[model samples]
Target: MKTLAIVGAGPGLGLSLAKTFGQHDFRVALIARNQEKLDTYMQQLREMHVEAAGFSADVLHTAQLEAALARVKETFGPVDVLEYSPTPSITDVASVLDVAPENAQFQFDYIVRGALAGVRAVLPDMLAKGDGGLIFTMGGASITPTPMMGNVGIAMAGLRNYVSNLHEVLKPKGIYAGTMSVMGWFKNTDETPARIAASIYEMYEQREQGEHVFEV
Candidate 1:
């Protein structure tokens, strides 16, 4: 069976994605910083009879992330699908002049550095397999920059570029990489967890060479 490794597993998109893929018979490996939440999510997956495992690691910590990914590979084989979806915080939303230098640094470290770290860690295996999917959860701010959300927007823009570049570099190798931009509010809409999960699955299922942008 195909395996999926989802980083930044949370209450919304992460958990929903897990359930969606699990229902479709994909073995799932979930990663998050909170052990408790991971355990809770695993239990929920079990209720659906999904083969699931959890790993705890802050994406900002490269060593921890590496260890976690190693464990995932050992358990589920080379990951067929990878989802990167770290939730950005208010610290990640600061303007250059409004926040302390250290705070801005932290935001940059997590928003940009953490994501690149994940891509670096996973891309080699995907390239070797010559068939894999890297899906990044992107925000509208990437397309329309907001000064109030300065740092986060800038970091997301960088991620978008990274995804596009990766697509160019890896498509020839049969590794499909792309970013899914959530252009609308996810809360209180018909665009619920199920809808988003279906969209992601559809993208993964119908991925084409050089397809790098999925705006939803």
Candidate 2:
């Protein structure tokens, strides 16, 4: 079975992604910072008869993140799909006027550098196979800047740009790269995590390139 590795996995979209792909016969490898939560997530997935495992690693620490991905490959073969979407702590966020150098660096490391590490860890295998998917998720601030999300927006915008370019460059090589830019989370609408995950799966199946936006 193919493997889907979700970096920065959490209870929200991460679990949805796992279920969506696992149902389709993709063994799921979830990477996060907390092993306890990871165990809970794995048990939930097992209850649903999905082949899933979890690895604990912090995105800010690229070494641990890369090692986690390496473990995923060792356990489930090479990762056929890599989804990098780690949620940043609210404390790390700051407005444009108030954003500090430390905050900016933290966001950059969490968002942009973390993604690069993930790709570097998995892309080689994907390229050798000539078939794989690289999916990235970011907030709407990445597309349309919000002053309140200044530091995060900066890193997110860079991520979008990087993924966009990667999509174009990898298109001819029989690989898929795309970005999902969500503007906001509307609680009482059709924009649930499962729905968004289904959409992402659809995009992966279609091998669509560039960005897919989910607006309010």
Q: Which candidate gets the maximum lDDT versus the true structure? A: 2
Error of 2 at 48 (Å): 0.8
| lDDT per residue as tens, model 1, 99-184 | 56666666667767877777777778888878898988867777775667666776788878888888888888888888877775
- What CA RMSD would candidate 1 show? 2.3
- Candidate 2 achieves a global lDDT of 0.91
Over 4 Å off in model 2, which ranges? 186-191
Which pairs clash in model 2? none
lDDT of 1 at 149: 66
Q: What is each predicted model's overall lDDT from 0 to 1?
A: 0.80, 0.91
TM-score of each: 0.90, 0.96
Q: In candidate 1, how many Å is residue 53 off?
A: 0.7
Per-residue lDDT over 69-102 for candidate 2, one digit per residue giving the tens place of the 0 to 100 score: 9999899999999999998877788999988899
Q: Given candidate 2, what's the lDDT at residue 23?
A: 96
Segments in model 1 whose C-alpha atoms lie over 4 Å from true places: 96-101, 188-191, 209-216
lDDT for residue 133 in candidate 2, whole number 0-100: 96
